[model samples]
Target: MTGTDERPDAFARTDDGVSVAYQCRGDEAGRPLVLLAGQANNHHWWDGVREDFHGTARTITLDYRGTGASDAPRDGYSTPRFADDVVGVLDALGIERADVYGTSMGGRVAQWVAARHPERVRRLVLGCTSPGGPLAVERDASVRRALAQPDPDAVRQTLTELMYSPGWIAEHPVPYGTLGDPGMPPHARRGHLVASNRHDAWNALPSVVAPTLILHGDQDRLTPPENVPLLAARIPDARAHLLPGARHAYFEEHREAAGALVREFLG
Candidate 1:
């Protein structure tokens, strides 16, 4: 089961009357770590590695406005909007500051938060993401086709293929039957896609005062690994970690290594 399945659901009301869904785990000690998932994912994306942080930090996983149990409005899906939702979650939970980790499009959201609200973020971790603009690398045709798939099952299957390395997928296969639950709606997914495509953080990276870490899979097809160096170069105090032979789901496939790297970086 995923983390969301094991943890109780909670809601944080955004200023604009939207309810952002989240799940909090781990102990009350150390800085809180907020996890933001990819374009089409929810809190469950952290299921494989979240428990590794149980004793190290308070881990909070949130769903984007248009995904999961979060309130999906007709519009308003931007990186800044998502960043505000992050602040809303923290405010509702009475958390003053947090170390934020985001993947894919969520990484773009994290960039906005770190840039716009420097004091709210203690540190930032971005994985399998890019500094969107003309400078960023493009996704392969197959990957683009997969992301644009409308059917839930088709999307999940295509996503699985794009995420993991063939070797990893073969050794530890996913149970496709239990993949997507309460899948994202077509309109919401489209909103997320548009927001991601329009995100441009190249100019804002230098303003992100938080110590940043960029993690990418060397074999990542959706978000090219080439963007890693560009992100690290732009962020004032940033470093990059590229996992060899790994794909988009490197964090889940190499949970132990990724968890250790994150813990060390946060400390």
Candidate 2:
């Protein structure tokens, strides 16, 4: 999967009846680095960031059950179900184990995956995410309002405002545009966010045997650092790093450092 000119396209269907969308690049047979996207985002979340990871490993990215190019089963998508989707994707691609990275809502699913299926995950990298359930001052009011925000464009605007800082939105037009596209799976978004708000894996953190690297933006408004301490204290041997002046999309805003941390952790 290695080559700068080679870009992420799409993976075909697995036997379980879901047409998993994925892109492969970097080392052909190296340990797979699987990327899971945030809430309402598809496989395209790692669009530019793929190059950073592709250099050292074979990168595999999949749009979870209700996001991106994958099948959006309106009825079958919660946090745990999203973890199941990863299992399905790995099984479909014939991958038994992989290094995993996720952010925000994606990070939640990755936690569940790593905890529930430790054997399948070699290492874990979490960014701008939470362990789950009522972390800090979780204002369900705004989130709920955002959920029923009239229509797609409104939803896009609402999420963009909450997810990224004004500087990030201004400088990074690509993801800003990506977030505002409004082509996301609504059912998945509503379901996932609701689940994420109330879900907590604090007790389960002790069971995750895989090496873990947690990254969060110092200025993150989405998953505030206030709640991250619980994650660090609970997860054994898990290291947490704070990115200066970064928002929720810290990985992209500070791509070099984010990539470096990931490379180091994965190594």
Candidate 3:
């Protein structure tokens, strides 16, 4: 059986009147490690590393606007608005600077955090994320087809193809029944995906000054492994980790290995 959706330990109200949903784990006195989740994912991505890093850092995971426990804005989402929401979360929590850990679309925000408000970021860790929209949003036919399909079953099956590694599927195949029950609501998931697809940052990647760690699965189908070399070469102080046999969900596909790598990189 699948698990119930988890709740954050505490929530801070944002200036937009939306409640920025978040969970804090580890020592309250530790350095801040804020998790910015990717599109179609909430704080759930941190399930493996949350507790492990909590002792070393005050780990926090946030549900961006229109995703997870965060309020869905009526007008909808874009990179700028999403960036504002991140600022709002930090403001409410009284955090001045933080080590940002972002995945997929969350990584995009981390990029903006360094670009627009460089002072807010202490360091950044981006996983399976692209630099911007042009190459970022170009969808593969099959994945796009699945998103447009009316049947939820079809979409879930399609996403699984891009999300896990062949080795993972071979040994720990996901149960088809529970796979596509997305964490975010249906309408919101589509909006989040829309925001992710349309985001373009190629013109601005060079401006990022904060130290960055970029990790991608060599076998990634969605973002593709090529992006690893491409992103690392451009962003100054950026390092890339191309993990073999890993896929889109690098953390979940190789949780233990990823955990050790992250601890060292973040420390």
Lowest lDDT 10-residue stretch of candidate 2: 174-183
In model 2, which regions exceed 4 Å deviation? 1-17, 135-158, 174-181
Error of model 2, residue 264, in angstroms: 1.4
Model 2 quality (TM-score): 0.85
Best by lDDT: 1
Residue lDDT tens for model 1, 14-55: 889999998888776656999888876787777777878766
Q: Please say which candidate is ahead in lDDT: 1 or 2.
A: 1
lDDT of each: 0.84, 0.74, 0.72
With a 3 Å backbone cut-off (N, CA, C), the pairs that clash in candidate 2 are: 1-25, 1-26, 1-28, 2-26, 133-199
lDDT of 2 by residue, 15-88 (tens): 44666677677777677888887776776677767777766788777776556677766565667777777877
Decreasing lDDT order of the candidates? 1, 2, 3
Better of 1 and 3 by TM-score: 1
Runs in model 1 deviating more than 4 A are 1-7, 145-155, 176-182
Candidate 3 collision pairs: 26-54, 132-201, 133-199, 133-200
Which is the leading candidate under TM-score?
1
